[model samples]
Target: MNIHQLDINHLKSLETPFYHYDMELLANTLDAAKKAADKRGFHLHYALKANFNDRILELIQSKGYGADCVSGNEVQKSIDMGFPASQITFAGVGKSDKEIILALEQQIFAFNVESIQELLIIDELAGKLGVKANISLRINPNVDAHTHHYITTGLDENKFGVPNSELEKAASVLRSCEHVNLLGLHFHVGSQITDMNVFKSLCVKVNEWKNWFEERGTTIKVLNVGGGLGVDYQQPDENPMPDFEAYFDVFDKFLERNPNQEVHFELGRALVAQSGTLVSQVLYTKSGIKKNFLILDAGMTELMRPALYQAYHKIEKLGSSNQEELLNYDVVGPICESSDCFGKEVTLPISERGDLIAIRTAGAYGEVMASRYNLRDEIRYVYG
Candidate 1:
């Protein structure tokens, strides 16, 4: 089913704001990404931080995708939803000691270690449990992914990974840790990266590190090039597939791999962003001397991307006929915060009160980030 059939007519009857997911579209996207990865024998792990709704997780698990979790709860959630523990890779910069112990109890496939301290912590916890915790050191290659500074993680300034200067020291510490088994290396440049050249640069960095590890008589078995593939928010239809072929092709070409080495990816947004839409109704339209405002019932409370990332989502009226009349409107929400505006100078068909507004490409960082700020009503959902 499409957006037109997602109970938009009865949307107002249920609630003022909620997220609607196109399951068919999401499945197709998963299939597309999975097929691309499978062609090159690359493993695809769905980044649960993107969208962890139980229904979404179930479908993704059904498609044979592993779970890339950042917390203990996410690992439990994935396991509860039928994802295999052997397929789960726990990753985070600040995992708590309790979280580490929980993962050790579950025997997760690997922990993406961000720092040497974290590696020692994991070793201590694993020693307590009398089990070797498999781990992959997250390396900061200092490659500029050319994305937003806030989202760019591989740079030297970011606190997400261990810098190149610390790699040998981290490796030395890992070798001395008796309870931790060094699995391989992992690198994540940033999120919403649209440029293929950034990934090509990342591949070059991965190759250099792989050789570095091999030179030390340590073979890197798993090379996890973390996912930051950007989706086309401007033109969803024209580039819906998200260039997975090109993304996997880069690794297939530039990444030097051993016969037994397995390449893995942790994809989040590109798999689910276009498959969902946050459908809301325009409560009022007020024109002022300075600007016209479309007051939406769904604020950043429902979809926080606009407020948090200053991100853009194409907004369209569901049944409006005045498509040709262009007008500038600051799409505002009922949230009391001044920063709750979705977009400034957003061009939409002349909208009116009670007209449905569909926020396109909200499937990824949309509803999962919703909150009850301003004592707002509970958000709902309609799956197609």
Candidate 2:
């Protein structure tokens, strides 16, 4: 809704339904995060799954941040974008053989190995390549992220990290693997986490597990507390950036570590969400007895969070008239699916065809999740 950072006149001339990125905001966010992490000697690896826009990746890489990749292509993209192999970390529950080999060839910093079988397979592949692979055990701390169920990943039921019951076996497998080097432990509770106490709970689990591994005679080098810091979707303007200082302070204050150990984070949404906006033009306005609908040229094909997660993003009618009249309407996209709606009962100025609408807090997952499901046009972007 607050788009003063964007060139409104230029936005009006472009075709409707494009993502507009505020490069300055992104730079500031990165600087703030980097300074916070650096002051506490924490390391940051930007999660590429969040956006991965070429320009965005270029800027993020320019800042010397590491890459947190979830797939094979992502690993290559990070390298292609100039992120050093030593700064890239591959993580996923279902990694393919090809991905493993590519990562092995790349000599990435570490693989957040999720299962004992994955550990054995990586070791086997590394042995075949005659190279030692650095790995960190992705431990399922079972800590609740207290966020969306769809985004939660650290619970016992989630298929992300290895369960506590299997740690003994994982250690046994690690002891037997000749080509794999144990780096440390990795734990990602979930995504879009807002509660600081959730992280505190996670710190407790991390400490417990680190001690658990140490008691078994394994030396820990890195403590990768995966990132899930939430953004202010409800008020993106008021809080354009997350409190990086407080976030890092949480780890500094609570997380116990040794002088030789390193602290790392894999942040995705918090770094980019507020810096992007989805701009679309109203296609039509239809008023019904039960519901009023403002159809837009964009839909779930463009931004899937609403349809997929019932997510809330601040929607505002741009170019409000001096005598603007407010009304409640269901803002929807022109897609054929009923779930294509963006927001229901959204209050905005009495809008008409050609009126511009800005969907805020969309920088992270919005553009990356776009699809051609409805044979829609390829998404476009505008940067300022």
Candidate 3:
């Protein structure tokens, strides 16, 4: 069933200011992505940073997808959650010596190295542990992802991967490091990228980098073009599966590959965003001379995207009979900060005290980023 239909029955039972996740919808979305990736013989790794809920991780792991972790805790969590260490890939900019030691001890598949210094650190750590650490260089392809400036990471100005000019030096450093095994190359442009041209551009950049390495007598075995596929926030119902077919097709057509090379992707939001919603209740509806305000019990502490990025999510009233009565409202939450508002001048059905409200498309970065600010307690979560 759709969100509105599920809301009719579940809204009454749920406590206010909670997260609601539709497991069926999430399963379908995962299936679609898996099917598309399997068609091209591509490996998919679920980026745990998107939503690290144990239940979500269990479902994703059950689907045969690997885990992409960025921290020591995440690597441990992935292993604890039944994901094989052999299917896990650790990635980050500043990996601590402790983290490197842990991964080497765990024997994870590979480490997505971001800099030459980090590679040296890993090599040293692996040497101390008497292990050969598998590594993949995270190269900054210098391509514009054209997403939100805050989330964009591939640009030369960003503090993410090794610069394009440093590849030779990085490779030379890897060659001398006896404890580290250089596996391949990894490129992640940015996040929430809707434009397919960005992926196509990334493919071109990957091909260029591959040829550069090949010409230097280096054989790249794995090509990991990182994931930033965006979902439809305006109309979740109209486009639930996130156009995985088109996303994978772009890489299939543009990315150049060798016979021994394997392609991999790390996706997070496109898999879990649409499956969850932030459910809250309207605490009060105040009418002023200027405009109406619908105050909610949930605030930025529960879902901060609105205040952080001025992002939009479809706000709907649950179990409302007056759907046609149009009224403008500045939806806000009970937080000390004025910036804790969800939407301004939003049109919704005539609202009242205790009316249930659901913020759509909050599954990815919503609850995972929640804070205990304003002395607020954690919200409950319901899975269906």
lDDT of each: 0.89, 0.94, 0.91
The residue-by-residue lDDT of candidate 1 on 40-72, one tens digit each, is 999999999999988899899999999999999
**Cα-based TM-score, every candidate:** 0.97, 0.98, 0.97
Model 3 Cα shift for residue 141 (angstroms): 0.9
**Among all candidates shown, the one with the greatest lDDT:** 2
The weakest ten consecutive residues by lDDT in model 3 span: 1-10
lDDT tens string, model 2, 1-384?
Answer: 237645568778999899989898999999999999999999999999999999999999999899999999999999999999999999999999999999999999999999999999999999999999999999999998888899999999998999999999999989999999999999999998889999999999999999998988899999999999999999888899999999889999999999879999999999999999999999999999999999999999999999999999999887675588889999999999899999999989998998899999999999999999869999998888
TM-score of 1: 0.97
Summing lDDT over every window of 10 consecutive residues in candidate 2, give the lowest-scoring window. 1-10
* Model 2 pairs in collision: none
Query: Per-residue error at 367 for model 2, in Å?
Result: 0.9
lDDT of model 1, residue 222: 96
Cα lDDT tens digits for candidate 3, 109-200: 99999999999999988988899999999999998989888889899999999998898899899889999887889999999999999999
